[model samples]
Structures are given as structure tokens and as C-alpha cells.
Target: MDEVPGVPAGLLGGHPRVLAAAAATGRLPGRAALDDYRAAGARAAESGVPLRVLVETALVMAESMDPVPLPALRRAVSALMEGYENAQRLALRQEEVARREFVDDLLQGRADRLAERAEHFGLRLAETYAVAVARPAVPLDDGSVRDGTVRDGGGVVRDGGGVVWDGDGPARRIEEAMVARFGSHNVLVAVRDGGLVCVVPGSLTVATGEFTHHVRQMFAPGWRVGLGRPHRGPGGVVTSYREATGAIELGDRLDLRAPVLKAADLLVFPVLLRDRAAIEDLVTTVLSPLREARGGPEPLLGTLEAVFASQGNQTAAARRLGVSTRAVTYRLERIRRLTGFSPDDPTQRFTLETAVLGARLLEWPAHAPG
Candidate 1:
């Protein structure tokens, strides 16, 4: 009997029926060889051989024997393909378990060797990266709940409700989409903190508006995304992740409904919210008159934002507000009389803008305590 190169002798030595069948038919035995091929498939999977290589090896071994009937050879190849596919699925499941463990450790701050661990998963940690977090706009049905936790790309564990969004469907879609755009190795999407989190390469200089538009179009209408500023290194990934979560939290608190919120644009409110007493004081002292205005605080606040956004240009601000320039001037005059701060002066304009920002952050007049 001819020996198969690179295969251990013991593998075939113990399977005499397989050898006899091969000798007689010049092809692997049907049904009889299934057990032997299954063993071979398991070993191939363990050795990390590609399924293509395993299929090729099976064909080569079958052809090496004296001429076998075409029908018999075809049957043998189909059986080998089935065995290889089964083994491949098993191998993939095992790999996913290991990858999830590594990702969990990395996110929990337990993995000290970031570069080494990242490389093991075919990731490059040296490049600039940003984290994006997404949550569903609608709640999932209770029946869809499987375990207390669901492992998507990465895993997330939550308290209270004891449920976190699996994000399996959307997270896979996100990873596939980003990979298609940026290449397979450039993006990583995981499920964390009841949402999908993606680590994408490139600096903030990359047009976030364009990226946000793409995400909004690609994802389902129910998804809301938040992006962090780009930073370098594996450790910086944690910082970026925190920034992404903060953006989502702040956006929800302030009721900003843009499809994607950028952490860079929300830098001030989060810090100001940390000093709640100061924010309250600013609302009380500088914004009290506007709160007591005849038409309510929203109209004046809207005008202030428009004026500031237009850089004190009454004509431009009026255009944006869909009002006449004289109306814009009247609003600014009312603001000056009520708050004792003139919008015409750059210095007072700065203070008034700061106070308005504080009021919005605190949701003053609407939710302020009496």
C-alpha cells in the first residue's frame, strides 16, 4: 500500500479496512471510510489546516491510487467535504470562545500585554483608533432574551435588568460593513454596555460628518450612534470608549437627537454637569430674567443660539431663525434688557453665551427646581 505523505503512519496503520478499501477501489470507501475521514478532519482542524487544503489533500490521495470509477471518487470527495465543513464549524466556535475571553480581559483592564493580545486576534494596536457606541431606539421583545448575557463580538454584562443587547445581528453587519470599506484588519466591533461598540482606525481629521451620515444610512432607523475622538495606542482605546459612552449619556440627558453624537462637540456640558451647584447658580443668576420672559425661555434661548451661531450677525441670524432682521434686533434688545448683558459687546456676549449653555445643560426653566 502507498503511504500518504505528511500524515502520521499510525493514523492509517490502525485503519486496515480503509487501507483494504483504498487498495481495491483506488478510492476511499464510502460509509466505511466516514469514521476515518472524520478523525482526519478533527486532526486537520487542530493543526489549523484550511478546509481548501484538506479537500485538495483528499482529492490527491484518491487520485494517487490506481484508476477508480468517477462515481466512486465523486462520492468520496463529497463525504470528505462534509466532514471538513463540520470540523471547520467546531474550530470556529472554539476560536470565538477564545477571542471573547481575550476581548473581555482587554476591556476589563485585566490584559496588560495589549499589543501581544491584539496581535493574537489579527488586530494592530499601534495605529490611531476611535471607539463608537450604538444603542437601539426601541426595546427588544422579552421573548428574544436567551441568557442573562449575550456574547456578540465581545461580551457585556449588565446589572438591574440583567439583560444587555446581544447586538449580534447589527454588530456583525457593522463589522462587515466597516471591513468592506476599510479592509478586514482595520475595524473591530463588539457588544458592550447594552450596545455595539466599534473600534475604527484613523484620526478625528477623518470627516466625522460623512462617517456619521454613512452610519445612519447603513444601520436600522432605531439605532443611535455616538463617536469618540481618535487617539493612538491600545491604552487609548479605553479612553476613547469612555468618551463614546459619555457622548451617548450626555446626548440622551440633553435630548439631542442627532443620529450620531461626537464627543468633541460635547466637551463642555459633561464637565459643567459635574459641577451641578455651579450650573444651578449660573441658571439662577444670569438666566432668571429670560426664564420669566413673557413668551417663555425657549424663544429667547433659540434666538441667542442663532445669534451666537451667526457670530453676532443679526441679518444672518434672522435668516436662520426665519424672521426679519428687525425681529432679530428686537430679540437681542430684549435679551440685553432682561439679562443686563449686551449682545453687541464681545465680552458680555461671551458671558451670555456661557450662561445660555449652562441653562441648556441644566434644562433650566423646564425642569429647574423652584
Candidate 2:
């Protein structure tokens, strides 16, 4: 009749039996529980060994007697309680460390493993997976931290929902939540310096109108996030990661909301972003009046856009605008006379086309007929 069936410690000593006795019956060993402790001892003598023996040893080892010897029994009990608390805390700290080491080992093995896992994850998801760039909400020495990454080293994205929700310590909770939303089990999160990486599945890769709100909620105090286009497998994952990084970098360079630039912008030059300045003058001076409907020149701004898009090809421009070719020529001549841009010149045409797009962004006045 050992106090606890699963544990056997009686061979070591009687002291351990006290802990085993208390643990077995779910009661602190009073004189009554001591009977169980004794029974555990008896069982140990008969069987190979009983758990109570070692448990008793542990209990005794944990005991610290006060030299003064005032109320020694009470003091001993208090010391035992303290030891239990300490043991619990230490165990928790050790477990946390162990988990971290586990993750590190997984990361060190080779990206190939993660790649393989991510591919399976991607297939399981059967949906387009996107890599989001998470930046710190606040600025850092090298670059800004992406959102939530500081709070939760890795975030799991949910389907149709932004990963803005705080996940408990599981670290994979956010991903699990996404699993619920997207209806897939293939999801993984990898954390790297400066960002959190995620693998998702599905066909359309970009965060849609549905995800925008969640992105802000997922945002943390010190980090920001920019989502990358959805990609497939390793190539897609890498592409999305690069895009997310680019978005963060580009966002950092531009004032918030100057615009959300995409990965394609990486190939563009600084001059091109500012080059829109060249078209500002033409738009403000010539196209402004044309856009005015009440007592303004006939609305030829549409005409202007079509003409520019066509590279000044009057026939093509006419077809595009649903106007006759002759009508297209008249509008082209009208534009040249009003704005000093001769549609025949290829260079002038290029400038006008670029200007139109830039003008829309710069918030310049409409084209006014000269």
C-alpha cells in the first residue's frame, strides 16, 4: 500500500516518504497522513522501492532548522512551503530557457527545413500566403521595429482578420488564430532581427480590404508593419519578405501616409519619385481650367489623360477615349496651343504622360486652357 502508486522513493529514506504521503492523499501530513507515510515505508520494504522514500528525502533536504529553536515545527513547515515555491519558480525559468533553445536549434539547422515545412504549410493552407513586414512602433538605432514583434516575438496571422490580437505566451497563438480564420492548419512564424516572418497559404497574396483594419490593431507601441504581396513556396516567401522589408524602408524614408509604396518601388529611383515635380507646372497652368465645369473650358482633362497614355498617337488616343480620330487631333492641337506641348514631339509626350500621373498625386490645380 504505497502512498502514491506511480512514485517509489522508499528505498532512499523515510523523510521523502512524508512528501509522497502528502502528495498521494492530497493532504498535508498531519499525524493521520503520517500513517500513509508509514504505510508507504512498509510498501517500500516489501516491493523493490516506493516513491514515498525519495519524496521524504527531498522533504527533509528542503528543511532548514532555526538555531534559536523557538516553535521549531512551525518554522520547519514554513521552510518547506518556501522550498516548494522556489522549486516551482526555478522550474518555470528553466522551461522558458529550454523552449528558447529548442527554437534556436530549429533555426540553426538550415532554412531548408523551414522551407520544406513552409511549403507543406503553404499547401495545407491552399490559399495565397503573404509575408508582412513588421516594424517597431517607435524608431530604433538601426531601423524601426515592426509592430507586435516586440510584444510577441512572432505573430500568427488569422484569415480575414488582422493579427492585431495579443496572443498569450504560446507565441504560436496568433498563428493558430489565423488558422481558425483562414481555415487551414499549415502556418508557421519565424522571428528574425528587425521583423517577424510568417508563412501563409492561398491564391490571392495581398492583404485585402478585410486585413487593413486588423493590421492597425495588431500594431504595437514600438513597432510598425508593412505587408508584402502574397507569394508561393520558398520563392514566394523570399519575394514577400523582400517586399515587406522594402515597404518598411520606403515607409521610413517617406513621411507616414505620403504613400504606401510596394516592392516594385525598389527598382525605381529617388529621382523618379520627385520627378513628378516636372509635370506640376503643366497641370496647374493648362489643365486646371479644362477640369472646371461651371463656366470653365470644355473638360479636356480626360482628353489630356487619353492623349498622354496613347503617347500622343491621335488615332489610338481617339479610340481609347471613345472619340473619333479627328476629334482626337483637335484635342491634341488644342492641348499644344494651350500648354506649349507639341504632341508630335516624343520627349514632350513622355513628359506630359509622367506629369499627368504626378499631377494627380501632387494635389495641383486642374488644367486651365491657355
Candidate 3:
């Protein structure tokens, strides 16, 4: 066994003694001897020795022992293999539990022993970190749609296409890929609310795109990514996570088509949301008049949205609205007459655009305050 090239060094130091004791049983190893061998197998497994090498060593040793029968040797080896597998399975399970607990504590701002656990998980609390959260653009059927509220403390809410935490498949795949690509340190990927959330060092410029690419490759297109800026310390993880979550919810509300949304780019929306009363007043004052238009406010609101998105190009706005250019022009005229704001003017257009964005974020008209 020591001469075997593939065998892990020091793995066979005590194995010979255990195998000899088992071989003394003649036909089948006694319980005591088999138990000792099983324990030895577990130790080897814990030390990261390959099972194949251990098994091959046992078979080779058994060949040299005259008293032990092949059937008894086989049974003893089977017990050893079972012990090895059980130990490995338990280790893997414990690792997974630790990872999930770390993720929860970090994301939810639970600071109990956070610094200690953070070190164990390869996170340096002193350094800056950013979070990237990704999910299928079209929500998957996670069966939790009817289930109210976030279950895992991952901040997955029922805003728009809530990312329900599915099984471990996607998360596992993403974690493995990330570890392979970025090495096993300072990168953590976990499943929260059915989306893959990755915590990477802020210095990685391509993390956002790389994470999105992996998700798209694994789950296909129709996936969206939200990224949060880098922040320092344990509290930074929480802040970045919430930022990513808000970006996804905001993107969904605005029906954004971008594959990746950054919190930095959407900072203005949160500023607008900070004064809900003020924004509501703005939406109500600037846009509520559109309700008087024929076919209610949706058609006019949609036309305004298209016109702003198309940068005042009437033909492009018409194409987007699937109406004739004349119809778009007529809607703009109607908007001007109704709200005294012109999409044609650069100054007034800004006010109209901001108000329109506020309406979407507030889910106006349908949920508009009376």
C-alpha cells in the first residue's frame, strides 16, 4: 500500500494494523475488528483520501493474508466504504448548513458573531464588497407565488416577479462556476427567494457581466441582473444586498428591458421615493389630468412614455406605440393642452418624464390615491 503511487501519503500508516486484526477472523471479520476498520476509513475520508485508493489498498492487503476468506474481506471492505461515504456526506451537509446560515446572518444584518463567521467563509470584513443578484426575466414557477411574504430572510418580496427560492440546483451550479472562475476565496453565491445572489469583491470589474452570463448560460435568456455598489465591512453586505433587491423590484415595476440593472444608475428613483408625499403630489398634479383623455389615462400615459423613451422622435414613438405618426402627434398635442406640458420642449419634457416615472413607481391610476 505504501508503494502505490496513487495512494495518499500517511493514509496507510494505521490501516495495516486494522486490516490484520480483521483478517484474523478467518471467515468473516468480527464486529470489533470491522468497527475499528470503519473508524479508520472515516479518518482517511476526512483527510481527503480518495476512496478508490483506499479500496485498492485493502484488496492488495487481503491478497497477502492467508487466513482471511475472500467473502469476509469483501464484507469488511464494504463496511469501510460505507463509513467513508457517510463521513463525506455528513461533511458536505454541514458545510451547506454553515453557508446558508452565514448568508442569512449577513444579508439580514444579524450581527451576532458575524465577524467570526465571516472569516470562516473567506470574507474579509475590512475590505469593500459588492453584491450582484440575478434571476430569470420570466419568473419561474416556484410554487411560492401564493405563499405570502419572504420565507428565508433574503428580502425576497412580492413586488413584481418575486424571486422564489427554488431548489439547490441553480445555486449550486452558479456557486461551482464562480468558484472555478474566481477561485474559492472571497466569493459567495447563495439562493435567496429563488434567485442567485453573488457576493464578490468590489474590485472585480466584470463580476456583474460574468454573473449574468453564467445565469443566462445555465438558465437561458430572459434573465435579469441587479448590482449594488461596493461598501465596506459586515454592514456593507446588508446594504449592498438591499440595494440589489431594490434594483430588481424597481426594474420590474418600470418594465426595464436591460439585462443588468445597477443601483447607481437607479439612484434617482430612490431619491424620488424618499418623499412619497411629494412624488404623489407631483404625479397627481402633473399627470392626473391625462385621466380626462378618451379611453382613460393608459393610452396617453403610454404615448408619453414611448415619446420620452424615443427621445421626441414622433415616428419612433409611433412605431413603439404601433400607431401612426399622426396619432402620436395628436396625443402630444392633447397632452400639451391637458397638462400645459409639451413633449416638444426640452425643459417641459423633463418634468413630464419625471412625473411619468413617478406614476409607474407608484403604480398610479389603478392604485392611485383618491
Q: What is the C-alpha RMSD of each candidate to the true structure, in Å?
A: 6.5, 14.0, 6.7
Task: Give the top-scoring candidate (TM-score).
Answer: 3
The clash count for each model shown is 0, 50, 6
Give the per-residue lDDT digits (tens) of candidate 3, residues 313-341: 98999999899999999988999999999
List, residue by residue over 246-276, the lDDT tens digit for candidate 1: 8887777665657678899988877887888
Sorted on TM-score, best first, the list reads 3, 1, 2
Kindly give the stretch of ten consecutive residues in candidate 3 with the minimal lDDT sum.
150-159
lDDT of each: 0.67, 0.48, 0.78
Q: Model 1: residues >4 Å from true position, as ranges? A: 1-36, 64-76, 111-116, 122-170, 173-188, 200-217, 221-235, 252-265, 293-295, 314-334
Model 3 misplacement above 4 A: 1-40, 66-78, 137-168, 220-222
Sorted by lDDT (best first), the order is 3, 1, 2
Better of 1 and 3 by TM-score: 3
**Per-model TM-score versus the true fold:** 0.67, 0.38, 0.81
- Please give the TM-score that candidate 2 achieves against the real structure: 0.38
lDDT of 1: 0.67
Residue 289 in model 3: shift from native, Å?
A: 1.4
